[model samples]
Target: MTSCGCLMLEKVEGDASAKTRVKAAPGAGAGAWCGSCAGDWRGRSEAIFPIYVMGSSRESTVAAARGIVDSPEDPIWVAVKAEAKSEAEKEPILSSFLYASVLSHDCLERALSFVLANRLEDPTLLATQLIDIFNDVMLNNKDICRSIRLDAQAFKDRDPACAQYSWALLYLKGYQSLQSYRIANILWNQGRKVLALALQSRISEVFAVDIHPGILSI
Candidate 1:
């Protein structure tokens, strides 16, 4: 089963009891499984399920999707790095800062971890310690990692002033504060209440955005 430049729902060769596997159709450029649909279809016995595919055939779709998911560098990170490099070349004063903040890191999570740690750090809570915590949380939790990029994309899309994704990531205090709160919330859930509160304090002090770490509403 396939559609023109769309998703291909194919039945896997296996026992009848086996769950169906889903992938992009060939020529489907960088396909992604729809979250709601995936959740709904998970563990079901049905062989033919509805999926949304943007590109073409089964082989190419699967390959493209795999490349996007398995690849260490994503489009968002690549764009941010390119923008940073361009800005660095144009403005000599910001070159060093851009290098340290965006260019030096391999991915959005690492760069964001560094930026947030530095922004929230103080005499008591060192930047190194915060980086470890942030990196641990962000890298370990794939959802958090995805959300960071989505938030960066949102800033670029929604804010007229935000000309580049790197600007939103590096300079937006609101964005920083939001990400800090996410980490703090995770800490609170993991029973690190004291550390979460400490992060909350730093968030308040630095970004002037007061949010309780205990708040589950992200």
Candidate 2:
């Protein structure tokens, strides 16, 4: 793994426990960097503690810092994933989607990136391309993902019809619509007008919810 700082994205592809590894730096705290010669790299304690820059660092660091603490996993996502695991064990039929969508990912943003990419992807527009874009957006501006979590949480907190995170994770069209709009809005502001409009149209068609691209978000 290329060394950026204290934390490294250590992956043993097939190993469940090795998805991502973070080495705490020497101060022996959450964000402390390793003081050893090989691991030593000058940086702030708060910066390296959590999942690590995982940026000069980019807008991603700024965005991600808002949502994450000392770990990569979000508590809300953890609870939802546990529910998915239980549901998968109880119902064999839903296992494939459950595992592919939620269980396979290490973080909430990653899973969202995968699902949205697949949903929006087409023959000419590859899933990899969509995934890359989604990852970029999420990493650069994690407030987007945080907004999504809040949106999903709102359903569970407020809507009587919605009781489970899995349902919002998998089947909520309105939630999907809002997320698609947010992604498209990012692209639109970044001067990718055509792609943004295309996504907006596709989102409307898929979710049956119309959202104006030109409309300003509060």
Candidate 3:
């Protein structure tokens, strides 16, 4: 269903279930998860709890719900990634999706969703785009994004409270061409091919995240 910020309780697309769309109980505060069911609300907007449960069949729905409520402690990042995959399918409906899952998912999932959703064509703009959304997520959805930036910042040895959350460390690894992408654009007027290649190898070893070679070559 189309949303305009306020909580929406529309039926799922093609849903065959007889259950009615549920709403938060009266007087429930923000980030409160109240429903007819006995389960506790895990997300910020009470609205998201339902959408997260829109998978096929009751079993799948329960499994999806568990992903959000469970700790990121087991299997580490896998649960976070599972939640992300669920959110990704609901894109462009993201404002509502994010609002719904806000409290359910952790800070890391929130920041990463911003990154995954906004991936684009221009290689040179990658870092800038990541930082821009990171800031927006931090400023606009501080409750969710704050801890993520702090965690990412801690990895870089920077103060968690720092406003900018310089993405240098996060972006620096993975693809070989990313290093080249940065250098190529930074000194666009001056060429530095050799140093770019060296940076590429360093990224591969450290991040284990691969860059599309074609993206770099271009």
Candidate 4:
């Protein structure tokens, strides 16, 4: 097993409990790191958190923060906006200043919504979708004019100057493979026998994470 920080990614050619041997990073606490690190939906109580507090709607920020802390398992959650009844409360809202923050990126919206609505068993596919969305938004969202450049600059400043600096790291280290098999395990646990079998083959080809014969026997 290879370790990063306190987290470990096991090389389970096909172990039933392979994923359960690892721990999820604090940032990834909400999402299942693997089999063993499955945590409750409620947020972690760790003192250090990853909340982006740039220029954004305070209400939205608070709501988003609360959502992350409160519902770790949720991929998406709807927040209620407060309507102003008086002019004093109706201050003109400016554009979002959280342009470069990973959490604030609009590409994450769909996956979040999907996760919140359903206790999604697999975030691998959703994570891939999020990456594609980010690429599309960064390369083609033309309405923002100069803001796009500003946001792009911000991301460059905040992140390492590498192609796989973001969540794509999941694929680089074969985390995506574990996620797929975990999803398949979930389906198998849920008694969706046919679907589980179908996923097994797909996951093998896509992730290249082998399922060992001994692990399968479990």
lDDT of each: 0.77, 0.70, 0.38, 0.35
Worst 10 residues of 4 by lDDT: 78-87
Off by over 4 Å in 1: 1-73
Give residue 172's lDDT in candidate 4 (0 to 100). 32
lDDT of 2 at 81: 94
**lDDT tens digits, residue span 1-218, model 3:** 11222233444445565343645445554433325322322332234443333222456545643543454553224433454455557665664644333324445444444443243214443545544533443345433332343333333333333222223222433221243243222222234444334434433444564443234432
Cα lDDT tens digits for candidate 1, 1-218: 23444444455566666455556767765554455444433323132532322222348545644554556769778989999999999999999999999999988889999999999889888999999999999889876776676667667755777888888899988788889899999899989999999999879988999989998444
User: Which scores greater on TM-score, model 1 or model 4?
Assistant: 1
lDDT preference between candidates 1 and 4, better one:
1
Error of 2 at 122 (Å): 2.8
Q: Residues 46-77, candidate 2, lDDT per residue (tens digit)?
A: 24343322222447545544454434567668
Model 3 spans > 4 angstroms off: 1-54, 57-60, 72-76, 79-118, 121-126, 138-218
Error of 2 at 7 (Å): 55
Off by over 4 Å in 4: 1-165, 168-170, 212-218
Error of 1 at 175 (Å): 0.9
How many clashing pairs in candidate 1? 9
- Candidates ranked by TM-score: 1, 2, 4, 3
| Prediction 1 global C-alpha lDDT | 0.77
Model 1: ten consecutive residues of lowest lDDT: 45-54
Cα error, candidate 1, residue 67 (Å): 12
lDDT (tens digit, per residue) of candidate 4 on 42-61: 12311122242233334755
